[model samples]
Target: MNKPVPPPRLRMALIGCGQIADAHLQEAAKVDSVEVVAVCDMHMDLAKQAAARFRVPGIYDNLDRMLAEAKPDVVHITTPAHTHGPLTMKALAAGCHVYVEKPFTLDAIEAETVIAAAESAEKKLCIGHDQLFDPTWLDCRSRIAAGQIGHVRHIESTLGYPISGQFGAVVAGDPRHWVRQLPGGLFQNTISHPLYRILDLLPDLHPRVEARWDRTKYDFPTELWVQLRGAEITGSLTFSSSVYAQRVTRVYGDQGMLEVDFDAQTIRRHTAPKLPGAFGRLEMPFRQWREGARNLQRNLWRFLKCEIHYFSGMRNLMAEFYRSIQQDTEQPITNAEMLRVTRIMDEIFADCRSREERVEEFVPETRELEVVR
Candidate 1:
């Protein structure tokens, strides 16, 4: 087979010199058709530090200055969630396609505004919902598409993170952290990952959200359950602070089930055997063992091939975003998907906050009625 021709080189600039900027730069370096021309941060020293570290050609403390000078074909927004909408608008206005990190904005309205700006500017806006493009994640979708897993009846996505992780530690230490300012608190910052995974399988663009925050268990909410009711498929997202830190999504299909574990980077399928119940039960363990062995072998091969990167999904996502630019094709992650995820998040935040207010109001009324009695 003939190797495909390479796309023309495109200039790229990165904003936000936070922890996530490193990930973006690492992935950008892997994309052969793109050059990291500039790095920007609100602080010049930080911007200079990142520019030096990545060997980027230019550094700027202002978005407009960088955009005018770098004249990049694409801009990567790695800033905080609160800053996403404005940064996206700035980039799109500057005539550069934007690749923004997830939790598109603080609310759906903000998301809609940015989408409109991107559309008006005739540019593509791709969010960093990178998990959906993962190798195991893609394999699961392919199985469902090929009818190997039958029809997907439902999906369950779970994110179990530690309350004492490096980032969480910063938030825990100070109420003034930007994450705490989010309407849904830390949940808002992280829930987009698993929720998008479930949303990708559902047919409906809009889903009914029923969520409850469990804060009484501790000083702050450490567990949350969001029930999503879609047209044909129902899904749930569970975010909890637990001792076991793991990430997994299970797709419940009619013929069988598939589980994608992000932490282990493994995909396993479970199916009913054609034999009798007892024999099927006996064979199931062997089937599982075989799958485990297969995954191990695949990982070994990938490691030896040097195709294993900690953030391979992030790398692949950038590659496709650039491909869209090169081919003059549709975005890898469509603008519609970005809006849907944000809308769902907006619904969740509103529901949670409204319920908390209702509870407080009811408590005062109940106390008054008790005194009257």
Candidate 2:
């Protein structure tokens, strides 16, 4: 008789038990190829609680000890930004694939180090830029690529939120301890997603930091305006954490434009004329009226209920990770792409620090035109 085949060996560990760790746990539970064998956190109690909550067999306050004993196939690093680089290197050295949270490191050099370690260890490294996996983003990208919008000329991406004092207070209370330590504030913490997504859609694009400004008086910069120059296109990115609550992206091409309101699960397309002529510049009366009505309805609907149409792209993100592992292929959001994004962010932060500007400078000025009486 043939010898019994041993069970497939694929164990995993969670390196941080913070709020986002729950998102990791929820996604990991849905994947069948791996088992969560252990969890580790700087706080022993947090580790134990997470292990119990996830029904894992091992728990430790020390990451090194956990790695040595658990010998997990993958280690998810949801720790603070400062710890991400070191924790990732340690896990990679121990022969474990790493899934680090967004803004992989505090700076580009540190991010490069993590990338180098992963390359040397011959293990996979993925960053959590989940917005790239959103259904609306995917659809928009597909349409743009298929020439539905023709040659891409430019793009505009914006994200913001409003809660000044309360927001700072919440960040201060978090003992995970690194948010306060990081050099850049909301720009690094929040806006990195849109900055990266815009690049992902236009891979050949090389953005030059034409201008950097800020306006908020927080400990770190809260807004950024970046201009990117590609081989044949130019784009602008505006990111902030100051608006009451708004997140929207628009991509423009020679033929048309695609607008995505991910928070509202709506996609709007404005197609240009197929042939240029005197009538080409004329706006179709019915189309204009329809668009105005649709915009009003969407705003009113979203105002009534905050969570009505928000599309959580968690499922797609998980699927991509699993597929990357199975196919042994580079993911859409590869380590290289992540490093590029980090580098751009690092440059922005450096520019802001060197210039010593206030956050309000980065905030974009919009005409306060009334949409409703």
Candidate 3:
């Protein structure tokens, strides 16, 4: 009998050559079935640098030229948030599956249009909500599915950004940066990370949203607080630039709680102690030590396997996306999920604007005034 045939390799190309593009390229290299055929960027120097680092043969300063010349089967759009919608539509039109980096689009309307284009083109579309695929998050989901946490009651997602970080500094220095032009300003560029967590755990697709925006700690409004309520669960999201960089999500269930720390790549499960009163208090430290030991062992194993890097989640997501395209299976992230998150973000920003306007109206003197020397 003849052996079964293997599927042909896939040709992948990247459209943006920014810092995030390196993560995409490095992760793509781990997928055995895909090849980095080309890279394109508005800045030719950035494109050339990426090609040289990844050993990609084709590089171009124009998307049309790269699409025509490289003939890639998949294109990864890691450009700024504003360009996501148009670039995705163009890639789908060019007969290529697309993986768009997040803040999927500026608004839900654009998200709907781009997704429709991908559907019309009959190609797979994936978003860069890779945090959901992180090892810690994966373990948390598995534990929840196994009834370790019972029914979830509430979720809190927090993302802290340091204003001194590379990207943050860029935005701070350039008054006209693309992020500043976003409706939600800097928050629009990052809130998606924390927001996606709540949307995934909450059953409601259209949750009621309330938001407050403030800039007490920075020249621009770099802090956001959002509250969302679904049918059975309530969630809150926090994005702060004043705080030290941290990424954490906590899910509280009837029986216990699960906390995932993205910055440390660890998860901790909490539950009521068997002992009562003072005994329970005494047992808490021991329980924490056990949890820490478990996390250490798990991370050590992953480290030995060379999977302890920052972009491990991206690698998993990219592999799944490529496999979906190869086998004609559903994409890892549903179009509905993408649209729901976008819509919620839109509602949050709208509320934030209204609140800001009310604040300005109530306290006219509080508004910034030009100081004369």
Point out the higher-scoring one by lDDT: 2 or 3: 3
Query: lDDT per prediction?
Result: 0.87, 0.75, 0.92
Off by over 4 Å in 3: 1-3, 365-373
The lowest-lDDT stretch of 10 consecutive residues in candidate 1 is 213-222
- What is the overall TM-score of model 1 with all chains considered together? 0.94
Enumerate residue pairs that collide in model 1.
none
Best by lDDT: 3
Worst lDDT window (10 residues) for model 2? 364-373
List the candidate numbers ranked by lDDT, top first.
3, 1, 2
The candidate that achieves the highest TM-score relative to the unseen native structure: 3
Model 1 lDDT on a 0 to 1 scale? 0.87
For candidate 3, give the lDDT. 0.92
Tens digit per residue, CA lDDT, model 2, 131-151? 777766777888887897798
lDDT winner between 1 and 2, please give it: 1
